[model samples]
Target chain A: MKRIKKLDTPPRFISWCAVGGYEEKNGPLGEAFDLCDESDTFGQKTWEMSEGEMGRCALNLALSKCSLSHETLELLVAGDLQNQCVASSVGLDSFGAPFLGIYGACSTCTEALLILSSMIESGAVTTGACVTTSHNSAAERQFRTPLEYGGQRSPSAQWTSTAAGSFVLTSDEELIKNAKLSNVAISDFMIGRIVDGATADGSNMGAAMSFAAAESIIEYFKESELKPRDFDYIVTGDLGKVGTSILRAILEERLPSAAGKHLDCGNLLYDAKRQDVHAGASGCGTSASVLASYFLPRLEEGEIRDILFLSTGALMSPSSVLQGNTIKGIAPVIHIHSSAD
Target chain B: MDIYTNEGKKEIIKKFTPKTKVLKNTLLAFIFGGLISLGAELLREAYIYFGMSEKDALTLVGVTLILLASLLTALGLFDRIARYAGAGTLVPITGFSNSVTSQALDAKSEGLILGVGAKIFTVAGPVILYGIASGVLYGIIYFIYLYIIR
Candidate 1:
């Protein structure tokens, strides 16, 4: 590890950005959230979009902003929180990018970014797009019983924010140079460990995300060999308030003495119980949508540096959990570069 | 603004460039759509908190969902959710609304009975057909495999 004060950012990580969402008022997310419903009082606003339409909107947004034709992309790797990658199916139909539907639960965005950046960085591929979107309505139907079925939620549960978000990543030199996002560091650590067949009831996502987030954060520290204060921010996936506290307490209990600033997408998205969001944010799209609304601009503005983004995912299987199979979690960190020459 | 398929409205706004309008002038769309699902959950919780049976809760949730769905479709709110939330908002019951309206509107262009009455059933028709067909296929396959194995 050479101590280079101000390392010149790499040419490898240059990507374009595009956003679409239903407008919200007075909230950071409101400005960037892509809308699908106006009457939906809870987060499933976009429930009217067929899986394909949502993806198409996101892809078109990315295309329009990047000014890249559909033919320009070598491959479009994307996924969604919908069961069996249904949303990705929608984006796949029209976008014509070679499709890759991924489901690492809510970690889909970071996961897509991981693979896309690696492909571009290593020169295995070029001019690729990595995107993921979560439609609130689609998710509610699949995970919870039908919205019409009106199901009870536990205190530990987090409401799914009605939103869809996406980003396009590439190794194109021109875009990176022009946009002023120079250096890029994709964290080499992939939290691929499972809980050795430990079973837990995770009907509510907070508990599930908490366990996974805790493991990844702890291991990221060990793997990167850096303290909490090394980076300006450590953003976790949508672990709303309760899970945020549980995760921090777990970390505190684990380290007993570690300290610094830590935030979760769920906690940062809104004012906990009082604001509309919820107690513990849990969803594959949670981190992605919120980050698009909040984090992306900050990176471009040079307000932050070296974001140690640990996107967390909880892998729960239908038979595995009921038949007493263990739940697994993965958290992969990437170093985001937003500085210029 | 009907989202699931192409509509005459899209033709009317063929040159409208909804990208900016869709992105800009729709705060209520974002807030209400985002919160609607949460509201459903909260309603369910309110029911359960009063010790409503899970079966009863399920019924209440269903009624609430359909009512929301009907209200949303009637007020044209579902279109906004479809635009903003993308699949995020559209994945749930609001989708059912769109399905009904999309088919009905399409059928209206044809005629009442054949169009509205006949076409409406077309909604989820393929899904049900495929589901049943697949189930039968699986049943046959399972029986054959069981016989072969035994």
Candidate 2:
């Protein structure tokens, strides 16, 4: 295999696990998740604490699945939608590995994976875990109004998934041999740029993020010298129904042939017609959980060979929104290949 | 085709923006607002039954509702109630109280005087200023109409 030298050598997945709350567990992809709690609060005191617990549970599940202890893990790279990524920090605090807290909003799952893979390729860490989480109550309270407030939701608004996904990566061949493996490897990645669509409305996240996803996908195709048909699926992170439509339209103009392969994690995360989620599911966990529960397993089973995982994020804070700053969108793409391919 | 252009970007974004559910929201507002008003009326009647005058009972009811709204906002319950109630929760005096209290709570992390104290009126500040101004203007007009005309 010819490796993209700039991106680094591909890192293989040792084990991955997805854990979700009640709403996500009841969704279409519910059966695919490794673990789920019936309660949104997960017996925690606050919604933030519940999110933290979900992250911790995902990491623990991933670690136990690989039969590796927390101390044996080289590093833990994780993030969440909460301010300061407190969910990840507090959730993974018990683990002995060095921690790197990152914030990419809803796209944090891919961002964490990209960083972990790069570290593995650099030979800096032989084994590392990437985790991302989001909670509905925590996100709602921070971004908009509290869930208790009877605020009318806009049709374009997405329900933040109360979920967490964790992936453990190992560069050591010996470790991979002993572990139950998915045989899915991260072959390459393209860091996305902040693309502003000149949108100032915080509620319209789909519009804010669609342009960035389209721009990044086009860039990935150009940089990899591959067409959209090259991958079995080109999955985007957290662009809901409306955002996906917007992205499809943009791609039709920019990369006309590639538009057909486009799929959005947000749109696919929930049953929109049955579920109250008007646009679709969003938040970092939306993409993370879907990948961990659905696509990663499909890759493992050789049902799919090559897939482009493009996670998009709206890099905006409540404070920034309050200050009238436009929401800047970002989308980072990672190429995942199954060993069978 | 170049979505990077201002016009193209705007056009595409507009297509994806979902419209507000005005009908459902209005219905919710009406129901919730009516319930809150009913509660206020009940409180006013209770105060009158306890030997308070009608005018004093009305004043007391308004203050009590404001206090209840502020308490609910602090407890983080008001927002959740407001979600389903929509303008129902917002159209009443309690809604105004919630706005002020919620902003103050949000800004509480910044510090006392600079944060909560300064930001407490962010949403309600304009309403208070305008409300007092209009009240004064109407009072002067009424005075002119009664005394000067007589």
Candidate 3:
């Protein structure tokens, strides 16, 4: 593979939006979301269909915010926690853009963004959208047991956030100027390697993904010759409270000064005490929705200048777990900087 | 960070892992299970009032509850109820029925014989097999006792 380096001309996020189910909307960051459907089903027959509807809803919101139509979108890169990324495919089918369906498990948000930004930087597409979604019931049925099973959740297990988040990005300066939107550029990114923590227990996903998050951060710092303190904030995707602590200890050993700035999207997405979320929020939407609802706006308002957004994913299928294979994890990092910086 | 070493990684993972809430979960299960049993008793009493014998009422109530659970599972409502009710739903016969029906429904797409037919018993098959085995064992023991007494 070619050496990973910072982009020569970073692609800017022109607009973004997050839509979530009732539970997430009532959570701590609830008010920060762009839209919240009162019904988890989104008026769909099945939970999977509802998840698809969420993706469509988020994409529509982002497009509307930018005053752009589906026709104006050059490409659509999206994924969900479902097999074959069916949610994204079915959800965004109406949009008349070339679709690139990618999957990185729950880390799909940052992974999709990485791909979208790279395409724009390569001059392949001037405008594209990165979308990802996850539904609690749908994911539970697919990854673990059906909801009716009433299986006890391990304390280490995270509650999947029922949400979808989309970002409209562009290399065109005119799009931003016309829309009168502040630019949030994708400054740099590091694609993580699949790191196995040798964990066989799927319930302890936080432990499984923590090593991947730490490795990605270390690799990014080494390649860029930057310290953790260099970024205004270093946020990880879906590594809940426990995973965050593990990540912190790992980072502190190598980059002690920067470890303190670390925050986890999963931990920040909900209030653990008030909410029944044992290990806090997770899924692709955990990071995607949080970034769209909270951090992206903060970046746009210049409240934060630079961010190292690392979305970690535990890549395991039900069959893999059944076969006694250990869970392997990957975390893709995206460096987003405000134009004001 | 040479922490990628096996021992170092294990230590980091262990340090951050949270303890399971055994007390809370057990309490939830106990409460829910009690509620389900209470509901069953109420149903049985209502059946008795309608002139059915006590034994018949009890048998009818169990069948009625199982049927109701399966219907709810089909409508995609039982799972939602189960989420909140937790162990309350799982400890009852209704929970067992829901598990069977839901798995069958999930496998419907794979076709009747190979999919739903095969997978319908995936969760409940062991319980059913053991239930029959124990019932036959009790019958044999009772017969032997009667023969010895005679």
Candidate 4:
């Protein structure tokens, strides 16, 4: 099966927005986020409910950014790092659109983008949005331990970000002909193959997911004949410090140019040392919030030309990790570029 | 070099993966765990100084440690200290108390019976099982020695 596909009719990014909790609001790109709740609760009683609210707020803000109403959206592709994707389903249920729920663990954001872009390019769904979110407290309870549990984290363990991101895309003929575009679009994308790096330690997810990121980048490079220097940056989802180092070493001999252009959302989302995030940040929100607030804006404003955004995910449940199964990883790459020309 | 195979990628990951500071973690764990033990000893001595019997004092000290650990866990302070303390809080009665309390706190959102009751032992269940199993095995050996050999 072909892993890479170049969109003949790329979908235009109309509007985007990001919502984050207190920790994320205090991060480097804090000011860039569209909305933030200092309480991290979003006025909800439960962490799960708070995570759901983030998705709701992200989608609402994305639509309102361009003064678009709810009726303007025909489809909504959304996901979250919750069991059965409850965060997306329950959170986005109020939108009352034709919704398609997806799960790619932390890579849900890019996966949703890839799917939404494909639907638009197919001309089946001309106007749609993709939303994804993750909460640290919720993820900790489900995937690792209780939020209040006293346990020492490994140096490689990444702190989960409490955040959400949403993007609105369209391939409507009338909108395109009228020059109503956000100046950023999905040009091409490559769906990643699941790869296991043989690291069973759950705390060190970067090791578990690094192989998938390397493979996705390598295959995309081979298929498109595009070197790493072709893009301004090769942004990875949340491989954090450990995954980034391993990815660099792997790409050093193969895709040599990639090492210099590589950037991980995990490292970029937070001040690791100041925040006491051992390795860096993880979760679907880590990449989604970064892409929505940082990359998409820069692309829209034409500050950067293009980026190969790879949202990587470690597909491991608490049961799988406990059963001694190796964590599988996947990263779907989307070639997002400025369409200013 | 071979990114596809597990063994090939493992070698690459090992090269780039940062090594955990074993010496530092060990020292910290040792010092912290010792501190907890010392605190327990001091509590027991204080109880005895107040005219409590030695046995009663020891039991009271154990209860105090569990209570303090539970309160700290609820106040969300134990985990912060445990982050730096490593196994310091984990190897003592406090760690056991924390395991149970943390699970209970997490499950409380689900409900009373199914959430807190059933899931409370999620983390500490194994310890309880193995601890009792070893005790039973030792009791059997002691019984055999006392009746047959002695």
lDDT-better candidate, 2 vs 3 = 3
Q: Which digits, one per residue and each the tens of the lDDT, describe model 2 over residues A1-341? A: 32233445578888889999888888899898999898787778777889999999999999898898998788899999999899998898989789999999888988899998889888999889999999998898778863444356777888999988999988887887787784889988877788985677777788889888888888777767777888898999888988888988888877887788888888877898888888898999989999999899999988998898988899998888878887899988888999854
DockQ of 1: 0.02
C-alpha lDDT of all candidate models, in order: 0.58, 0.85, 0.86, 0.90
Q: Which stretches of candidate 1 lie above 4 Å from their native place? A: A1-28, A34-49, A179-191, A196-199, A255-259, A274-277, A318-326, B1-150
lDDT of 2 at A310: 81
Candidate 4 structure quality by residue, lDDT tens digits, B1-150: 777788887787777777888898889999999998999999998999999999999999999999999999999999999988878889899999999999999999899999999999999999999999999999999999999999
lDDT of 1 by residue, B49-148 (tens): 9999978987898688766666765565655455445544544566555656555654454579876788674554665588799999999999989998
Q: Candidate 3 falls in which docking quality class?
A: acceptable
Candidate 2 yields a Cα-based lDDT of 0.85
Best by lDDT: 4
**Model 4, stretches more than 4 Å misplaced?**
A173-181
DockQ of candidate 2 (2 decimals): 0.43
Candidate 3 lDDT by residue in tens digits, A101-169 = 999988999999999989988899999999999999899878876555545577888999999999999
Local error of candidate 2 at residue A250 (angstroms): 1.3
Candidate closest to the true structure, highest TM-score: 4
Model 3 chain A lowest lDDT segment of ten: A145-154
Order of the predicted models by DockQ, top scorer first = 4, 2, 3, 1
Name the top DockQ candidate.
4
Q: What is the lDDT of candidate 3?
A: 0.86
lDDT agreement of model 1 with the native? 0.58
Candidate 4 lDDT over residue span A176-245, tens digit each: 5554446998999988888885877889898789889998998898888677898999999999999998
The positional error of residue B53 in candidate 3, measured at the CA in angstroms, is 5.4
